[model samples]
Target chain A: MNPLSVVVRTICDIFTWFIGIFGIYIIIHGHMTPGGGFQGGAVVATMMAFLLVSHGGKKTLSFAKPGLYTAMETIGLLVFIGAGLFGITTTFFFNFLAGQGGVFGATVPIGPNSGVLNSAGTISIMNMAVGLEVIGGLSLIILYMFKGIRLFDNAAESGETGHDR
Target chain B: MKKRVLFMIAILVVAGTFWGALDNIHPFGDVPVAPMDDYYIENAQQERSVNNVVTAVVFDYRGFDTLGEAAVLFTAVCSVLALFRKGREGQ
Candidate 1:
């Protein structure tokens, strides 16, 4: 696939990093604010789509390996599940780390106030985990679709049926 | 002519049902009773120490649901990857 004109590429290059940063901010601030992992991850994945569309498949593929995405997703799932299992001695998905005065273990005041960053223990960790998984999964979907379309183009050019033999 | 009449009837039926359902729905933001909401609002800060009640509900009170959502997304990715496997292997 041919990439878009230089103007679009320039815009994408300049703005994609900002989008990624905003998405990370949203994921991290999930327990304190509204947006969470899924929404933030979708935002980041939108940046990936912008890159893919402007740069074309070959350039995008050169930077983004599907294997790496798979690894990220796997790691995210493992971490999320591991975090959940940590509290199994009490109960499944117990909030053991809350109010413990450790990292991510500060007791929130019982009324409305400006929330602390390091307050919600396991919830914050899960947010990051889900964020990673969503970023990897969404990017992989778009990448796979683009690659599949290109494969059809290649088969057609080489005078072979794109369908299975 | 027959098809047009049938289509009109179908549209009317769908619109009427939607209107009826909308009429029955609680007015705007006014709920009759929200015991669960009150409970979560009162307890979430102490139980989870999170300012965002929605996040507390999602990641703590209803964590298994989030896990299921993650599984669904994983399954979708796996399906898409499987469909495109031939393309990768042929290269």
Candidate 2:
């Protein structure tokens, strides 16, 4: 079993929620504000990292395998490109799905000016697509770093030697 | 403890939400019927071959960049193939 206490786990959970929510906010209001897809996605991924660090693979990573991040990033990139290809027929970059307000104006319409789910334009769709890819890709990178550290720690515990004079 | 951190983040999010709501430029707008930029018109006229300004800029104005990117990807793939081939041959 892991050695961390309840206090650490609780603290980590709180931080994770904050960072994740904040990052999403930035991504949504990218055009009107300074933050955008890439920035916000990175912020969101950091939440997962926090979870992994404090709670170990059991709590934060039990839902996934080590290669899950890699698969997510690959699929996310493909999805992003698929969205970009829509520009060919529409208006050179006209977001076919950016109907009005949020991610799902049609699916989750807000009655008048679309809803929060409706994406605004091609850029917004592109923003979201890129955001997912960015989050997946960078999250994997962080995971790799920590995994490497864990490997080194295991080696130290085993009293493995590393000498090359 | 974790509660404090969560509270801090919650505070940040609430503050940010208020900030976003208060300083929104286009709080409400209809479907865009026209181009949002004038550069598209100018570029379309300057480069008349393609009808789509976005395509023209991507494929024409920055064709060289695309070519270089393609070349880099090709080279990386070739190197990876070579590395794998050598290991297989040794066995």
Candidate 3:
């Protein structure tokens, strides 16, 4: 695929990081805000799509390692499941850390008030985990779909010669 | 002509079902009484220490569902990777 015009590439360079920041914000603030892991991760994955659109397949594919995304997806899933398994003694997916006065364990006053970041315990952890998984998963899907297109083109070319034989 | 009549009957049946269902549906924004919803709203913050009741429900009260959703996404990615792995060796 051909790269877009220089202006689009330049704009992509400037705005990609901003898109990343916004996605991270939404993921982290899942407990206090409207957006959550999946929503935020989809937003972050848009950054990869944006990059692909501006930079074209060859440059973007070379830059992004499949191994890294696989690792991220695996790690995210493991951590999410680990968080759930850790509370098995109490109950599956128990809020054992809530009000425990540790990381993500601070208790908030009941009723309306300002939101607390260092609260919501495993919920926050799960949010981040799911966010990571989604980022990896969606980006991988986009990358592979692009690669598939090229693969189809190559296969078609080969199949034509084979048919002639 | 018979086929067209059958199609019309099918369409009318579907539309009538939808119309009957709409009559039974609760008005928008006026939620029906649900004890579980009430419990979550009244006690989610106190019980889970999360200001967002929806988050509490998703990640705490009904976390198993979220786990299943995550698993579904993982399987999708895996399938995509597997499908595209054939041409990867030469690249």
Candidate 4:
């Protein structure tokens, strides 16, 4: 699990934070922008992959836990479901909060205009939820693949060849 | 040779289908005449108070589909974890 070359690690260290911030902005402003939860989440996950690839498996694994990612994924799904259930008085996934004049409930004009952050009822919540879920899912996938590669490398080093075990 | 011919025929069929589909598809930068699209565009701002009609459609109007998508992603994560759990434990 040797660290990557000095240049790559340095660049990753410098740029990962900005990448993460951009992704969060995309997710949070999804209701008013073109990019939504999934796209932004993928961007953040890509940043994670970049860091993992640059830092090596052992260090990356030590920095983050698979359990934490699984928990995040679960929480995201639960939040999404809960938000949907909050609208169940009218329908399964009603926009109960829209036009109610509160947090994430401001009404917008009928035509094109500047977007408001505190608008769009459940959409914003769902965006954040989906973003979290996607980030967790994609990062976990990359981590698992890296772990498998590391395991196979170890097995080979130990001279334990073949698929018997 | 038989396999090669079959492969060529398959490629030809797929290409022809794509070509036909592309021919029928709306031209670039042209909006399709969909009442649902018009309805969403006209009503999303008033109904959902969101500027992005796409988000309104996805997270509000068609939330069940999003739930299904989330379920699919969760299933994938579960499968990946199940496959790699033993290796992780061994370490």
Q: For model 1, how does the per-residue alpha-carbon lDDT over A35-129 read when each residue is reduced to its tens digit?
A: 99899999998987898778776688789888888998888888888888899998888888998988899998889899999999999999999
lDDT (Cα, tens digit) per residue for candidate 4, span B1-91: 9999999999999999999999998889987789988889889998889999999988899999989988999999889988866444546
Model 3, position B17: C-alpha lDDT score: 100
**Per-residue lDDT for A1-165 in model 4, tens only?**
455789989999999999999999999999988998889998998986897778765578778877888888999999999999999999988988898988888888778788999899889989999999999999999888777675446754785433322
Judged by TM-score, which candidate is best?
3
In model 4, what lDDT does residue A95 have? 84
Among all candidates shown, the one with the greatest DockQ: 3
Model 1 pairs whose backbones collide: none
User: Can you rank all candidates by lDDT, best first?
Assistant: 3, 1, 4, 2
Fnat of candidate 2 is: 0.00
In the range A1-165, model 3's lDDT, one tens digit per residue, is 657789999999999999999999999999998989999999999998999888876688778988888888989999999999999999999988898888889999988988899999999999999999999999999988877775434644564221111
- Against the reference, the lDDT scores of all candidates come to 0.88, 0.53, 0.89, 0.86
lDDT of 4: 0.86
Which scores higher on TM-score, 3 or 4?
A: 3
- Candidate ordering by DockQ (highest first): 3, 4, 1, 2
Docking class of 1: medium
Candidate numbers sorted by TM-score from highest down = 3, 1, 4, 2
Judge candidate 1 at residue A104 and give its lDDT.
92
**Cα RMSD over interface residues, candidate 3:** 0.7
How far off is residue A48 in model 2, in Å?
A: 2.7
Where does candidate 3 chain A have its weakest 10-residue lDDT segment?
A: A156-165
Each candidate's chain A: what TM-score? Answer: 0.90, 0.67, 0.90, 0.89
Clashing pairs in 3: none
